[model samples]
Target chain A: MDFKKITIFAGHYGSGKTNLAVNLAFHHKAQGRDCTICDLDIVNPYFRSKDSEEDFKAAGIRFISSPFANSNVDLPSIPAEAYSVFAKSDTYSVIDLGGDDRGSYALGRFSEFLTDESTYDMLMVINQYRPDTRTPEQVLEIKKEIEDACHVKFTGIVNNSNLGRETTVELIERTREFADECAKLLNLPLVMTTYSDKLEKPNMPNPFAINIMAKDIWQV
Target chain B: MAEKVLMKGNEALAEAAMRAGCRFFFGYPITPQTEVAAYMAKHMRKNGGTYLQAESEIAAINMVLGAASAGQRVLTSSSSPGISLKSEGISYLAGSDLPAVIINIQRGGPGLGGIQPSQSDYFQATRGLGHGDFHVIVVAPSTVQEMVNLTYDAFDMADLYRMPVMILGDGILGQMMEPAEFPTESSRKLPAKDWATTGTKGERKKNIVNSLYLDPAELERTNFERYERYEKIKATEQKAECFMTEDADIVVVAYGAAARVAKNAVLAARDAGIKVGIVRPITLWPYPSDTLKEVAKTAKAFLSVELSMGQMVEDIKLSIDCAKPVYLCNRTGGMVMKPDEVLAKIKEISGGLK
Candidate 1:
C-alpha cells in the first residue's frame, strides 16, 4: 500500500492547482488508498474542490472546507477543520490552495500544519498560457513570490499547459520541457504532467507520471 | 435503494448527473466550480465513463455537444468569465436541440471580474446567453443538497426538452461545504439514450446533429419547433420552494445563494414579529411566474434580494405584473447582502404598508 503523504499544490491564476489536486486524490483512491482533499483556496473565487463535494462524497473521498467558505465576495479564512486534517499523522491529504499571490498568503496560515521532514510534497503547477506565468523564468518569479509569502520550499513541479481542446502533443511536450528545465534548475523533481484526454499518446519519452483527465475529477 | 451521505452543492451536482446517467464531462478549472469537473473526472472513468479537461470553456462545451450528440449524458461547468465564453456553444446547443448540462457558479463579471461570488449573470443567463431565439432550461440551486437534486432534474429536463440544462449557481453555493444526504449506489440508474449518435445502425436512420441551417425557412421551422418544446418545458418545469408564505403579509423573492440569505432574513423577520416569507425560484428560466403571481396577490409588497445590483428584480417585477410595489435589495460586484440588510429592506417596505 502506498503510504499516506501530504501533497500541497500551489500555482498562479489558471495554473490548474485544483486539477492536480483532484487528479492526485483520484489516482491514490484508484489504488485503494484513502484520500481526503481540503480546499484551502480563499482566493481565485472559482475552480476549487468545494464546488464538487457531491462527487467526492460518492467516491468515498472526504472533503474538508474552512468555515467562512461562502459564495459571497469575502476572502475565505482557513477553518479549524483544515488544521485538524493536517494535524493528523495518518490518512493521505491533499491541500488544493488558491491561485495567485493571495494563495501564497493563505498557505502562510498553515505553517503550523507542516511537520519537519514529514514527506510533504509542495508542488508548483505551471500553465504557460496564463499571463504572468508563460515562461519558466516567469514561473520561477511566481514561485519566488509564493515561496516568500508562504515561507515554504516548493519540492517539485507539474506541467499542465494546454490550449484547451485544440492542445497538441507538441504543445504538451514544449510545456513538459519547460517544467523539466525549471525542476532541474531548482534542483527539484519533476513530479508529473497532465494532459487533456483529448490528446493521443505523445511520442516523447515519459520522464514523469502522466495525469490523464478522465472527466472533471472533482465532479465525483 | 442506496445509502444517503451528506454532500455539498458542487459534489451533489456530480452525483445528480451520475444518477441522471451522465457519463461524459469536460471542463476547465475555475473557482466555485472546479469541484464539478474534479468530481466528474474522479468517478466517470471507473464507471466506464469519459472525463476530459478541455483546453478552455469553449472546448469543454463543444466536447459536451459532441458527446451529447452521441446520445450520452454529458456536462461542462465554469464560473462567470468562462460561462461568457461558453455563450456561443450554449446558443449552438440550444439551436441544435441537443441535450447537455452546463453549470455556472456565478462570480462578479463584465470582464475578468473578481472571484468573489456574484449573481450578475442573471440577465446573461436568463435573457439568452447567445444570439438568435432560444432558451435553455436553467435551474437555480440554493443549497449544496439542492445543487445535487436539481442537477438530476437538469439532465432530465434537458433530455426531455432536447435542450441544454444549466445549474445557475453563485460562488457561495459553489464553495460552501454543507451536510447533505446523497442517494445510495444501487438506486442510481443510467437513463435511456435512444436519440444519441452512437453510430446509426440496422434499424435506425442516420442522425445528423448540427446547429447551422442555411435555409432561412428551415431554420425558422427549427426555431418554432424549439420554442414549442420550450413552451412545454416552461409550463411543466416551473419550480419554486415557498417558505412561510402561506399566511405571510410580505413575500421576499430570491434564488440561488441569495435565496439562502433571504431565508435567514425571513427567519430573522419572523423572530422580530414580522410576518415575512420567502419564494425561492429553483428554475430561473421558467421564472416560477405562476407561483410568484399567486404570492404577489396576498403580500403587501415583494422584495427581490440578490447579489447583483437589481438584475433578477426586473424578472420578478415582470413575472408578477408589478401589481404591488416591487422593491429591490441588492449588492454588486461580488458583494452579498447581509441578512440584516435584507431585513432592513423588509422592515422599510413593511413600514410603508402602515
Candidate 2:
C-alpha cells in the first residue's frame, strides 16, 4: 500500500495493467482511503478498465472513463472528469493507461500536471510473454515510446509476466529474471510483481494479487 | 513444441500467417482488428516480409491481389465494413484463381453498425463475400488458439485449392487474450505456383492472370472447371467439431464466438438432465453438411445459436435437409447471446421434442 498520490499504469497492449489498476484501487480502498481509478484506454476496443465500472461502484471507488464505454460505439474520447485526478490532492488516483505509445497520447492531455514527480508514479507494466515486448531491449523501446508520447518519464516498473489464464507460479518464477533485466536496462525501480488471485500467492518481492476482470462472460 | 504464450487473437493470426509463409500483408486499420495490421507493421519487416498500410481497404485488397498473383502468400484483414470495401478485390482474386488469405473480424453491421462482436457476417462470408460464381474457403474459429491454427491452415488451403480463404471471426475472438502455441513451420508441403505470373525469361509461354473471359463457351468451360475444383475441395475439406452429439435428442449448431457460448450452454443443459449437444463448424464455406447430416439422423431437433438475427439457421436447415425443426436463438447489432438464454432456449426445445 506504499505508493504516490497518483499512480499510472502503462505498458504494451495486453500487459495486464487494467487488472492491476483495479486491484491497486481496491487495495487503497481497503486501507480506508478515498480512491479513484481512471480508464484512459482508447487503443483497445474490448477488455478495458471500464468493464470494471460496476465493481468499482460496489467498492465505493470513483471510476472515470469514456461515456461510450462498454457500448457498441468505440470512440477514443476521454471524459472531462478525468482531470479531477490532477485537481484533487486528497484523493488517491490510479490511472489505467492504454497500451503502447499511441494509447499513451491520451495521457498527454494532463502532461503539465504530471511534471511533479513527487506526486505521480508512472509504472511501466512489462509482460515478457507478450509478443511485442519479449526482450529487455524491446521493453526499453516501449518505455521510451510511452515517455515520448505522454511527455512523462516512467518512474518504476512492474513485472506482470503471465500467459493469460494459463499463468502459473512456476512460470512467474522462471520469468522473474526477464523483468529484472528490463528494470536494470531502464534503470527504474522494480515496483511490484503481480500474480493472479486464482493462483496461490508465490514467494516474491512486492507481490500484488490481481483478479482478471476485463474478459468476456464466457471466458474461463 | 514451442512454449505457449499469451497473444491477442489479432496478433496471433498475424503471426500465424507469417509463420505459414505469408510474406506480403496489405491492410487498413479498423476497430476490433487493427491489431492484426499493427502487429504486421511492427514485425513483418523484421521477419523479411512486406507490411503496407494502404490508404483504404479497397487498395489493401488490391495489393493482396498483386502479391498473390506473383505466387507469394499474402494477407489482408479488416472488420465488417472494411471487408465490404474489399469485396470487389476479393471477387477479382477468386475470378483470377489467386491464392490469398483474408481475415474478417466481424462487428455488428448492415452499414457501419457497431464495433462490438457479431457473427452477422455469416451470410456475407459464406454465401456471398463478393459477386461471383466462386466460393472462398471460410474458416470460423471460436478460440484464440484455433484462430492461430486456422489462420495457418487457411494459407495452405488457399494455396492448395487456388482460392481465397477467409478466417471469419468476431470482435470477441479478435480482441480476447489466450495462451496459444504458434506453429513454427507449415505442416503441409505446399505445391509450387507454376501458374504464377513470374517472368518466363523466354523459356515458355507467359502466364496471364485474368478473370475476363470474353468468349461465352470458354467462360462456361472455365466456370465448370472451377466448380469441379470446388466439388473436390468440398469432398475432401469439410470440418466440424461435435461435442457430445452422440445419442443426444437436441443438437445446437453454432460457430465462431457464438459456439463458445453455446458449448457452455450445452454443458449447463446437460447438468439439468436435458439432452443437448453442440455442432461447431470449423469450415463455414463447405458448411460441414456431412457432419450435420450424420448428427441429424439421431438428433430429434436442432438449435442454431448466433450473434446475428438467424443467419446460420438457414444453413442448419439446408444441411439437415429440414428433416427436423431447426430453431434460432439469436441476438443482433452488437449484442451477443448469453449462455443462460441459450440454455433456456435449449430446455424449451427439449420439452417440446416428441
Candidate 3:
C-alpha cells in the first residue's frame, strides 16, 4: 500500500478550500486508508472543521481542533498536539487552514517545522461565482497574495463553484476548465474539483480528483 | 455488543439511530445540527433507507409524522426556531402516542438567534411545548458518545411508551467531533409495529391516530394515563452524573454543554485548592431532582450555570428545598459561558476573593 502524504490546503473565505480538504480526507478514508484532519480554520466560525468534526470521527478518521476556536475572539494558540501530529504522522494528514489572507500569514509561523520537501502540497481553492475573484485575473491576484503571505508556492488548484444545493454538473465542469486555465498559467497542477452531491453525480471525467459532499451527522 | 468509541454527541446520535433500525428521515438544514442531517442523508441511502431534504422545517417534521404513521421508524431535527415550528407537530404526535425521535440542537432563541450554541430551550422543551397539556421524553446528552448511545435508548423508550423522545442538545454538542465506533448492523432490531397507523387488514378494524379526542371524559382519561406514564418515567428514569460531590464545599449544577464547561471549571477549582464539584442532569424532563435534593444535604451552596438567564436555577432551588443558596451564572443569545467565567462565578458564590 502506498503511503498517504500530508496535503496542506489554504485559500480565502468562500474559496472552497475546506470543501476540497474534507472531500480529499473522505476519499482517502473511504479507500480503507487512515486519514487525519486538523481543522485550522479559526476565522470563519460557521463553515469550518468544527462543524464537521463528528462526520470525520465516525469514519474512523482522527481529527484535532483548537479549543474555543470559534466564538472566542481571543483565538487560543495552536495546541502542541497539532505539531506532534504534523511531525510524526505516517498516515495521510490534511491541514485545513482558515479562509483569509491572515490564514496564509498564519502558515508562516509553522515554516520552521516544515522542510523543503516534507511532502507539502499547497492547493489554492477558487470559486468563480464568489465576489473576491470572479475573473481569472482576480483569481491569479488572490493566489499571488496568498503565496506572498505564506512564503510557500501553491502546487495545485481546486475549482469549487456552486450555488448551494442547486449546483449542476455543467457549472462544475465549467469551473474545472477555469481551474485548468489558471493551473496552466501559474505552472501548478489542477488538483481537484468539488460539487455538492445534491446537484450532480460523482462520476465526472477529469484529470484532477473530484470532491462530492459526504454525509453530515448533525443535520437535524 | 460493540466496543465503545470516544465519540461526540451529534455523531453518536446519528449512528445510534441507525443501530435502532431508524431508516426514514426528513429535515431542513440548521446550524449546530447540520451534521445529523448530513450523516443521515449519506448513510441512510447507503443502508437502503430514505433521506429527504424538506423545503422547510415545518414540512420536514410533518413528513416525519407521515412516515411514523405508516409504520416506519423515522425522525426529524432542528435547533431553537426550527424546533418552535416543530412544536405543533410534536404535540400532535405526542397526543396520538406515535413513537418518534426529535433532536433540538439548541441555540439562542425567541427569533433568528445567532448560531453559537446555547441551551435556552430548557423551558420550551420541558414545560409542554404546544397548546395542549402533553410531555415528551427529553434526554440531555453531555458527551458526544452519549448523544449516540441515548438516541438508541430514546427510540426504544419512545416505542415502549408510545411517546415522542427528544434529544435536547446544543451547538457545542452538535458541532464538536470526537472518536466514535460505528455499531454493527446485526446489533439492531426492528421494533414491533402493532400500534402503527398502517392500513388495517381484513382481520382488524381501521386504526385512527389523532390527538383530538372530542369527549372531555375520554380525553381526561387519556391525559391521566399519560400522566401515569410520565410519573413512571420520572420515578424510574431520572439520570444524573455527579462528580466529587462527596465532602465538597460547593456543588455546581449544569447540563448539556454547560455541564462540560462546569466540569472543567470544577477541575480547575480543585487544582486551586477549592472543593467544588459538579452535578449534571442527563435526563432533563425527569430533572434528577431527587439527586439534587440528596446532594443539597451536604454541599454548602449550589451554583447553576446555564446558557440562559436563570431557567434551570429555579428547578435546582425548588428541588433542593432552598436548603442551599442556588446561584445563577449564565450567558444568553448563543453565547456559551467560558470555563473562566464559570470558575469566577463559583469562586464568588463560595465567598472567595476574586
Best by lDDT: 2
- Model 1 residue runs over 4 Å out of place are A1-220, B4-6, B184-194
What is the C-alpha local distance difference test score of each model? 0.77, 0.90, 0.76
TM-score for all predictions?
0.65, 0.98, 0.66
Expressed as tens digits, the lDDT of each residue in A1-220 for candidate 2 is: 3788999999998898888999899999998999999999888788877777788899999999898887877778899999899995798999998999998999998999988888989999988888778899999999999999999999999999998878899999887788788878999988898888899887666888887776667633
lDDT of 2 by residue, B1-354 (tens): 598889999999998999888899999999989999999999999999999999999999999999999999999999999999999999999999999999999999899999998988888998888997989999999899999899889999999999999999999989889999987766777788999999999998999999898898998888899999999988989999999999789999999888888999999999999888899999998989999999999999999999988888888899888999999999989888789999999989988875
In candidate 3, what are the lDDT values of residues B1-354, reduced to their tens digit? 543333335556776787778998889977667767866875788778998999998888888888888777788888888999988889888888888999999877768877788888998888867769888889998767678778878887878778888999998788654444444543334468786777777778777878888899999999999999999989988999999999788999999878888888899888888888999999888889999988888888889989997999888987988888888889989776778888888878777522
Which ranges in model 3 have alpha carbons more than 4 Å from their true place? Answer: A1-220, B1-9, B183-191, B352-354
TM-score of chain A of each: 0.85, 0.95, 0.83
Better of 2 and 3 by lDDT: 2
True C-alpha contacts between chains kept, each model in order: 0.09, 0.69, 0.00
Better of 1 and 3 by TM-score: 3
CA error at residue A18 for candidate 3, angstroms: 7.5
Which segments of model 2 are wrong by more than 4 Å?
A: none
True contacts kept of 3: 0.00
Instruction: Give the candidates in order of DockQ, highest first.
Output: 2, 1, 3
Better of 1 and 2 by lDDT: 2
The CA lDDT at B214 in model 2 is 88
Q: Give the alpha carbon lDDT tens digit for every residue of B165-231 in model 1.
A: 8899987787654545445432333456666778766778977888898899999998888788778
